[model samples]
Target chain A: MNIVIIDYGAGNTKSVQFACHRLGFSPVLSNDKDVIRLADKVIFPGVGQASNAMQMLKKSGLDSVIPTLTQPVLGICLGMQLLCNTTEEGHTQGLGVFDVAVKRFSNTLKVPQMGWNTIFSLESNLFLGLKNDAYMYLVHSYYAEICEHTISQTNYGLNYSSALKRDNFYGVQFHPEKSSTEGAQILNNFLTL
Target chain B: MLTKRIIPCLDIKDGRTVKGVNFINLIDAGDPVVLAKEYAEKGADELVFLDISATLEGRKTTLEMVLKVAEQVNIPFTVGGGISSIKDVDSLLKSGADKVSINSSAIKRPELINELSAKFGSQCVVVAIDAKQIDGQWMVHLAGGSIPTELNLFNWAKEVEMRGAGEILFTSMDHDGTKDGFANEALSRLSTELHIPIIASGGAGTIQHFVDTFQIGKSDAALAASVFHFGEIKIHELKENLRKNNINVRL
Candidate 1:
């Protein structure tokens, strides 16, 4: 399978590539539009500020090519946030693939919400074999609001969409690459689909 | 609620784990890759690798170990012991380390914390503070807890947070390796004084110690070495005990 990891020049794509290789797929990391388009599956994974990531994505033209991906595409962390309509982080605009808006986690709770937390209300194929209330690793200060596309939800002082799906495009607020066992299973499920 | 993390730390020397464990099921006591995979499978929330080797060759081995562990274990892990610069942090991160912990080097150059945090974001920087009670004051120690610094423990913790450190791994020199328990008093003080998450390291012998660190110390995570390495305390069982104590843990 041709698995291409989008390199938007922000987050570390090494771990994501390593995760895929562990799953028995030889994944390629690239920013080339042709490489991304011709791939069987694409992974949009990133870290750092949303504005900077969006800027990098636009500069490379992956910003436009990403939303147009017809094959299965998974967006993780910053990549997932970029799929939303807009984000309060740096007041950046997103790809608008999903109709949700990203907002900073309320100060009533911790900002980053780092560490392991459970995800429930699973409805996507990405969670095919996973049980309800499965724990996943999360590390971010901003979260995508619960919307029609939300396939999974998590509670962290407030309920938010932990995972979202709109057609072939899938997004997760948490870092499945960093999450142990269950996280690998999620990636496996995504690859199978 | 975010659950308190139970981390198993491995002391490495020349890419091999320094602690010789005799767990019957373990593949090899000194192989870091084998031990790290075992810890991850056993439900450890995270893993830490402390490279005790001070040689140039040993640093390269630590990087190789980081690559091996990051590829095999699908969990967040931090690397520490010899990291001193942004280049070191960059190399380790590029090798797949989720975070980099700075100890003596951070003490020598306090601004190293700021530079690393600014460049890589605070979440990627973990400042490890080794402190001991000297003359009734908790004074920071350096050079693997042999030399003393003028920085007070509490004040240093606040500075670590202010300087953009994502977390503080506080290891009490007095309690470290003693196996009595974690220095809950110091840990509690650090937690209260600092807003960022505090990982209580140093002394952890039993499951109760983990519970005390979480409940009493208010630590966001508990890190242990000998206890976990020797199989003296099983992480799954310890987590079960914590769960029974009404403490949230990933089971």
Candidate 2:
């Protein structure tokens, strides 16, 4: 499979690539429009501030190219947040893929809800073999509020959309690549999609 | 609910895994990649690699070790111990380290925390403070708990949070390597004072210690070395026990 991981200077792409490598797939890391456009599967991974990442995406002209792709695209972490309508982080605008808004976690809880949390209310094939309340590694300060596109919910202080799906695009707030076996299964499901 | 984390810290020297009792008398454990894979499979929530290598060549090998571990291990790991600049963090994160923990560097120049959190995002910046109680006061120490500083543990932790640190890994030098328990009093205080997650390090010998650190210490995570490295406490069994105690864990 010609899997391409969209890399626009976002961190954690190496770990994502390594995850794919462990799953017996040699995924390519590319930011070129044509390379990403022709991939059998596209994995968009991000870690860092949202506005800065959106800026990088715009600079590479990928901000526009990403929304138009017809293949199965999986956006992980900040990549998922950038697929929403807008985010509270830096008041950054997103690609409008998921039709949701990202809001910062209230100060009552830790700003960045780090460590392992359970993802449940699974509503998509992305969670095919996964059980309800399966643990996934999450590290994010901003989360997409539950919306019509939300396919999974995780509770930190409240129920938030941990995974979303709209047509061909899928977004997960957790890092499946670093989420051990169940997470690898999610990535494999995305690949086989 | 977000579960309390069980982190098995591996002290690295010259590309090998080593464990020190009270930060001294290092003993070789095994190949880092092999040990990391074992810990991850055994249900370790996360891992911290503290590179104690003093020579330049050893540091270079540490980078290579990070790369290999990232390639093989399917869990998140943090690379720390002598990271002092953005350039160093950049290389380590690029090499696939999930986060970089800054110690003496952040103490010497507090701006380094702000700079790292701004550039890499606070989620990837972890400030590890090593402090021991001195005459009824928890005093911050530098250079792996050898050099003393006037900064109080609570005051420094608050500043770390204000500077935009995503988490604080507080190690009680007094309790470390004693196999008694964590400094729950100090840990709970830091957890209550700071809004970010606090990782309780140093004192961890039994499963109850892990439970106490989570329940009493109010720590989001607990990190230990000898107990786990020497096979005294098993990650899976410990997590199971924590779950039985009504404490949420990844197990």
Candidate 3:
């Protein structure tokens, strides 16, 4: 499969590519529009501030290309957050693929809810063969609220959308690549989707 | 629920794992990548690689080790030790490290915290504070707890959080290497006062100590070196013990 991980200067793309490599696939890392469009599966990964990432995306015109992709595109972490309508981080507008607005976790809990958390209420093939309340590694301050596109739910201080799906575009708040075996399974499921 | 984390810290020197690791079924015990993969399979929530290399060549080898570990290990890992600038962090993260922990550099120039957090998002910047109690005052220390600073622990931690540190890895030098227990009093205070997650390091001899750090210290994660390195406490068994203690662990 011609797998391309969109690299718009956002961090963690190497880890994502290595994850795909460990799964026996050598995924390409590219920011070019045509290279991404020609991929059988596309992985969009980001791990920095939202507004800065959005700016980078807009600079490369990927903000427009990403929303128009017909292949199964999996957005991980900040990549996932950028797919939403908007995010509270930096008051940035997103690519508007999921139709859900991302909100920051209240200060009552840790700002960036780090470490392993259980993700449940799985409703998509992305989590196929995964158990309920499966632990996925998450590190983010902003989360998309539960919506019609939400495929799974996770509780930090409250129930929020951990995974969202809207046709070809799927987003996960957790890093399936860094989430160990079960996470690898989810990545495989997405690749095979 | 967000479960508590059990982190096995690997100290690297000249591209080799320092302090003997006693894990069985290993051709090379000093190989950080192999040990990292073993720990991940054994149920370690996360891993921390502290580069204790003294020379420039050693540091370069440490970076290569980071790349190797990142490629082989599936779980999240942090690379720390002598990381001072955005350039250093950028290379490490680009090499596939999930996070970079800064110590003395952050203390020397507190703005480094703000700068790192601003550039790399708070989630990727971990401010590791090594402090010890001196004359009933918790004072921050530099150079692996050999040099002392007048800055108070709680005050420094508060500043770190305000400066946008995603997490604080607090190591009580007094409790570190003792295996007595974590500094739960100071740790609980840090957790209560700071909104960011606190990772309790040092003083981890027993599984119960792990339990105490999470329940009493209110630590989001616990990091230890000797017990895990010497294979005195197995990650899988330790987690089971934590689970039995009603503590939320990954298991």
Candidate 4:
């Protein structure tokens, strides 16, 4: 299947693209709207700040095209944040796919909940073989608050959205590509979607 | 909740891993990729590839090597050494690196942080501070700990955060490779001061050391080496221990 990775100029798409290649799925990396519309699956992965990422999406005119996707779309890290209503990183707007705002982790705890954190799985096709509390790799400071569309939850100092799914759009705050064998299994699950 | 991390750092020289005690000794560890994968399975929360040969050997500047190791394992990785500009940062991000850590280059050009953060975002930029406990003060060192900067650890850390770095990767040169246990007091102070996650590196000998670091140091994550490379603590076992300690690990 053709997995399309959105090149919004803000994410670590190479690793995700390479992971898809290793998983026997060929990914076409492009910011082109026509190419994205032709793909069977879409993956939006990012590592940079939130505001600039949104600006890049707007500049490329991909922001308007993103929310219109009918195929299964996965947003990783910053990609997930961009799919939210707003982000605290730069007070920038999001794609508004999910009506949630990304807030910064309180300084009372660590900023970026780095390293491996557990995702409490709920009823969702994104986590098929995964157990109830499966560990996933997370590397971010800003988090999306609990919303109606949340499919999984994780805690740093308090509860936050770990995964969000609505319609054909799915968003994960952690990098599935960096989450070990569990990550590979996640990619496999994402592929079946 | 997340378990505390234990990372192993590999300083690559001419494509081979190099080790040093107190940022000295500079002994050979093994091939960077093999040693990295070993540390990942053993107990490393993350792996750091610092290319010590780029300026000297005229090599690939650690990007391709990072990509090679990244392709092998599904773990978050950081690449340092000879990273000088926005172009370098972009290239490394495109090379599949989760984070790009800056040391002397950042010290020389603080604006680099702002620029990279503007484009790639702060999470992609990890400011690495190599410091030594000198005269009862944590003094920041530059150029692979070969030169000491005028900035103090606390001050520089605050500045780096203000300048838009997502996390601080602090390595105590004095305690590095000594396996004497981390400088918990110093780490604790920095963690209290910085709003970002502080990754403590250097001076880790056993599992008890990891425990003490979390209890005393209160660091968000811990990075180590020899203990992991020598088949000491497995990453899953370490997470289990952290979980058993009621540390709120992801079980």
Per-candidate Cα lDDT values, in order, are 0.89, 0.93, 0.93, 0.81
In candidate 1, position A84 carries an lDDT of 94
Query: Least lDDT summed over 10 consecutive residues: which range in candidate 1 chain A?
Result: A105-114
Q: Model 3, A1-193: lDDT tens per residue?
A: 8999998997688899888889999999899999999999999999989999999999999999999999999999999999999998889999999999999889798888999999999999899899999999999999999999999999999999999999999999999999999999999999988
Please provide, for model 1 over B24-116, each residue's C-alpha lDDT reduced to its tens digit, 9 standing for 90 to 100. 787677888998888888999999998899799989988998999888988899999888999999999999999989999988888999999
Give the alpha carbon lDDT tens digit for every residue of A1-193 in model 1: 8999998778879999999889898899999999999999999998877888888999998888999999999999989999999999889999999998999877666456779999999998899889999999988888888899999999988899999999999999888887887898999999889
Q: Write the per-residue lDDT of candidate 2 for residues A50-93, one digit (tens) a residue.
A: 99999999999999999999999999999999999999999999
Q: How does candidate 2 score on lDDT? A: 0.93
By TM-score, how accurate is candidate 2?
0.97
- What are the per-residue Cα lDDT tens digits for candidate 4 across B1-251? 67776676777777667664122212434656666666556546677877778564434635567778867766878888888898887777777888899988889999998898777777778999999978988999988798988999999999999998988888899998798998899989988887888888989887777787888898888887666655566667776777677665544
lDDT of 2 at A105: 91
Interface RMSD of each: 1.3, 0.6, 0.6, 1.7
TM-score of chain A of each: 0.98, 0.99, 0.99, 0.97
Fnat of model 3, as a fraction:
0.93
Candidate 3 error regions (>4 Å): none
What is the full ranking by TM-score, best candidate first? 3, 2, 1, 4
Ranking by DockQ: 3, 2, 4, 1
